[model samples]
Target: MIRVVLPAHLRVLAQVDGEVRLDVEEPTIGAVLDALEARCPVLRGTIRDRRTGRRRAFVRFYACAEDLSHEPADTALPGPVAAGAEPFLVIGAMAGG
Candidate 1:
């Protein structure tokens, strides 16, 4: 199982009280997200754009203290994350004027 920690808003939308656990074979960023969307259909377009399939500008991904937002979708997760030892984090970015 892969642990995924969604931002508060997303958790609320997903109606989940805590981290989400998913079973993914590849454990790539893309695969993990695909599994999340598959499990929680309500979150289809929140983290990524629906049409383009690109990550939203105000969303970020992290694991093992590394900023994975800019990483390739197929990038493999860190050892701990893929091994279910660490949780992959989905964060909402703060924007200011």
Candidate 2:
């Protein structure tokens, strides 16, 4: 299972609490997101584009304690996440004026 941690707002929107676990055949960030969306349809458009299927502007991905800001679509996630040993945190990026 791929553990997922949702931001407070997203959790509230999806009416889910704590970490969510998903099963993914392929160990990629894209696949994980797909599973997340499939499991929680209410969070579909909140994290990624509904049409383009791209990650949202304020959404960020992290793994292996590194920032995957410019990673390609096919980039493989960390071993822990890929092996379903660790969670791919889905945190909401915060901004301020």
Candidate 3:
């Protein structure tokens, strides 16, 4: 099972507590996201753009201490993440004036 830790807001939106566990057949971020959306339909457009299917500007992806928000969607996740050893983190970026 792949583990995903969503930001608080997204957790609330998905009506889930703590980290979510998923069975992902593919190791790509896109595949994980597709499974996430399939499991939580309400989160369809919160993490990525509905039309472009791109990561949102304010949302960041991380795993194994690496920033993957800008990586290609088809890129395979880190070995730890793919092996369910590390949790994929979705953080809501903060802004300041």
Which one is best on lDDT?
A: 1
Q: Report the backbone clash tally of model 2.
A: 0
| C-alpha lDDT values of all predictions | 0.97, 0.83, 0.94
Q: List where candidate 2 sits over 4 angstroms from the true fold.
A: none
lDDT of 3 by residue, 1-97 (tens): 7899999989998999999999998989999999999999999999999999999999999999999999989989999999999999999999989
Index of the highest-TM-score prediction: 1
lDDT of 1 by residue, 6-66 (tens): 9999999999989999999999999999999999999999999999889999999999999
User: Runs in model 3 with CA error above 4 Å?
Assistant: none
Ranking by lDDT: 1, 3, 2
TM-score of each: 0.98, 0.90, 0.97
Where model 1 places Cα greater than 4 Å from the true spot, the runs are none
Error of 3 at 23 (Å): 0.7
Backbone clash count for every predicted candidate, in the order shown: 0, 0, 0
lDDT of 2 by residue, 14-80 (tens): 8898988898888778888889889999999998899988888898888767767557667788888
Q: Evaluate candidate 2 by giving its C-alpha RMSD to the native, one decimal.
A: 1.3
> Residue 65: error of model 3 in Å?
0.4
